[model samples]
Target: MSRTRRTLIWGALAIVAVVPIAAAAYSPFLAWRSPVYIVAGFAGIIGMVLLLVQPLLAGGYLPGLSAYHSHYIHRWVGAALVTAIIGHVAGLWVTSPPDMVDALLFVSPTPFSAWGVIAMWALFAAAFLALLRRRLHLRFRTWRLGHTTLTSVTVLGSVVHAMLIEGTMENMTKTALCVLVLSASIKTLADLRVWVIRTRRFD
Candidate 1:
């Protein structure tokens, strides 16, 4: 493709990807919600957006960024994701403590609640393992396997949880974003192929 054509094509693709997210952020259903609900809803949106970025960074797919900077930003973004998850659950808790407790205990009436709780805990576990990698003296293969497993669960659960909730996010956009996030995560894992190669070597 010619340089100008390539630039225009990329720009169009960016717009197509971003407009839905922006529309979801300003979803009409969100307009009159209480502060706590609003905060929780937006936090969830941020979490979904972060989910998409995380794998892209890890897979080094984002253009114009060096591998060193991509990895560095990935770590920082991981921390930010933790904060976003906390804000999401905490805000919901503030709005309804009993419901939050029920969700955490895995007895929530809502189907989505269990998935969110699962993802939240998995996120924590992933971060904890990453932090203690050196101290635990884990082999690279083992650490990678465990980390990848937890992240896979986290992404899957998070996407399902978000999709099940009938909340502020616009349905079409939210679903599109969820699909993108899941695809990005799965693609990243497949590209890494850490576990696949390890198994092949053993076999």
Candidate 2:
């Protein structure tokens, strides 16, 4: 990519990634919320935003990152994604154990709760697979397939979860972020053509 185009891409990424969080920080709705609730909500927002970054890094689409550095950052981003989610859930649970229980048990009256739970588990599962694929003797292709499937689930569940919530995040920015995340994920997956990847014995 040309230097100018790279700069534009990075700028666009920053806008989409940062705007919603910035908007949330200034939302009037947060004035009445508890500190734990505010922290939990922002953690979830950060986690969802990281979803947009994850696929770009995995597909090496992020500008200026070498393959090694991209993969390295991808791993660290995965760790951050997990931590943000854990903080999101743990904070919420602390703030309201009953709601968290209902959500975890799939009995929450709010439909978004189920989707959030589903996404959380899907993300955790994908992360676990990524961490243990080598120890599990998974081939390269097999690992990719499993990880990609779980990740797709995570993205789908998360987008739905986020969209369904009538919460602090601004609707316009949330929708834009969701569209970008889905478009980027679909583009990367379509480009990979993973079915054509041949699995060798050593791989």
* Tens-digit lDDT string for candidate 1 (1-203): 46687677557547645766678677778767788888887787888888888898888877666878888898899999999999999999999899999999999899999999999999999999988988999877888899889988899999999889887778888888888888888899888786653542210
Model 2 per-residue lDDT tens digits across residues 7-66: 999999988889999988888899999999999999999998999999899788988998
Global lDDT for candidate 1? 0.83
Model 2 error, position 36 (Å): 0.7
Screening candidate 1 with a backbone cut-off below 3 angstroms (N, C-alpha, C), the clashing residue pairs are none
TM-score leader: 2
What would the TM-scores of all predictions be? 0.87, 0.95
List, in order, the clash count of every candidate structure: 0, 0
The count of backbone overlaps in candidate 2 is: 0
